[model samples]
Target: MLTTAEILRKVRALEIKSKKLTTDLFTGEYHSAFKGRGMSFKEVREYSAGDDIRFIDWNVSARFGHPFSKVFEEERELTVMLLVDVSASSLFGTIIASKKDIATEIAAVIAFSAVNNHDKIGVIFYSDKIEKYIPPKKGKQHALFIVRELLSVQSGQKKTQLNTALRFFNNTTRQKSIAFILSDFIDTGYQDALRVAGNKHDIIGIKIYDKMDRTLPKLGLLRVEDAETGEQKWVDSESKLVRYEYEKDFFRITDYSNEVFRKAGCDLLHVRTDEDYVKILQRFFISRNK
Candidate 1:
């Protein structure tokens, strides 16, 4: 656990970094990447040559004896929800920063971007269950509160269950929202819930990982403990077959995660702890815009 001063310092550092990324790379892309719910009827006006004939107001046209068309405008206000995973697995990182650190930074950047665009921002922090839920709200203060919570949330239970979080989100939020799930994605069996949530909302997954997650170095025999379960085991890292199996499991998980996101019609982005997440996010936003 981090001390209050330490948490504050981390929050301040993340705020500075995320603010720069939000302003430089994600400002415009974030605005264009998400769209409003639907068009709203504005008013009826005399039909013009370029106006679509499908939108012609037949009753008004008949009454006025002239062609009239209904004008519609895109709803500008949007709601963005960040579904963050606070599972113990996020604490493991062999790179410069931990997976949790990367997730927190990215979440802060995204919240700032949404608020900057005049959209409401909300968050759901989960670890095997719904740990916290901050209702969607506008303004910088609200976004800051979320950032603070992200940095300081301590879970009594460390296990991960993505389905529970998705179910909670699906039930609580009725309106369409731009939802971002930030996690290391070590849990499974959430495909059905994910698909259901994706069908209702614009869902995006940011999978945070570390270089060591893909390939473990041969460090002789080491005792490892599961972050969530607290189970301990000893493994020989010198054996080639052991290393190969470890790598194969990592790839298997990665491939399955990608396929699940694709099948649900959602976008999946991979961000390593040592990589530039700002660039990765910018590219994702541009791709989504396209």
Candidate 2:
């Protein structure tokens, strides 16, 4: 557990980082990307020479005996939900920050960006079970509180049951919102839940992984352990076939995950612990804007 002073210091540092990213990089891009989840009718006005014909309010125009167009302004205040995985596997990292750290940083940036755009941000922290939930709210303080929670929350389970988290999110959030699921995705059997949730809300998957996850170093014989399941094994990494099989397994894992996301109709972004995340996020935002 972190002491109160430690929590305070960490939260302050995260707030400063979040502010910088929110202002310098993400403000304009986030606005363009996440705005206009849907537009609401603002008013009706007389149709001009080049107004969109689709928006013509025939009933209103017929009543007034003139063509009118329904004007709509974007409902800019959207609910941004971060479904963060706190499984034990997220603690494993060989380069730079851990998966949990990257997830926290990304969540903080998104939360602060939402605050800047007058949107409410919430978080759902989970392992196999839901650990904590911060209901969506606006304001800088609320955003900071979410960062603190992401940095310090404890998980009641070690295994990852993404289905549980997805079902909980679908049931808890009534209004359609943008949800970012940050995880290593080390589990399976969540396709149905993800499909249901994705059909209702905009779901984006942020897969945080270490480089070692996909490729292994030639370190001769090495001991390995399953971080979440507490299983240990010895592997002869020096053998070419061993290394080839290990690399192939990683490919299979990624292929399966990619297919799951495709079938669910969701977008995915992959971030390695050693890479520059800012560029990944920027590129993601630009693609979505297009």
Q: Which predicted model would earn the best lDDT?
A: 2
What TM-score fits each model?
Answer: 0.93, 0.92
Candidate 1 per-residue C-alpha lDDT over 1-290 given as tens digits, one digit per residue, 9 for 90 to 100: 78889888887887888788888787688988876566789999999999999999999999999999999998788889999999889888886989988898889998889888889999999999899999999998898889999999977778999899999999999989989999988788989999999998999999999998888789999898889999999989999998899899999998988999999998899999999988888888898688
Candidate 2: where is the Cα deviation over 4 Å?
Answer: 46-69
Which candidate should be chosen as best, given TM-score against the real structure? 1
Give per-residue CA lDDT, model 2, range 193-278, as digits (tens).
Answer: 99999899999999999989888899988999988998999999889898899889887877777889999999888999988888
Clashing pairs in 2: none
Question: Model 1: how far is 75 from its true place, Å?
Answer: 2.1
Candidate 2 matches the true fold with a TM-score of: 0.92
Give the clash total for candidate 1.
0
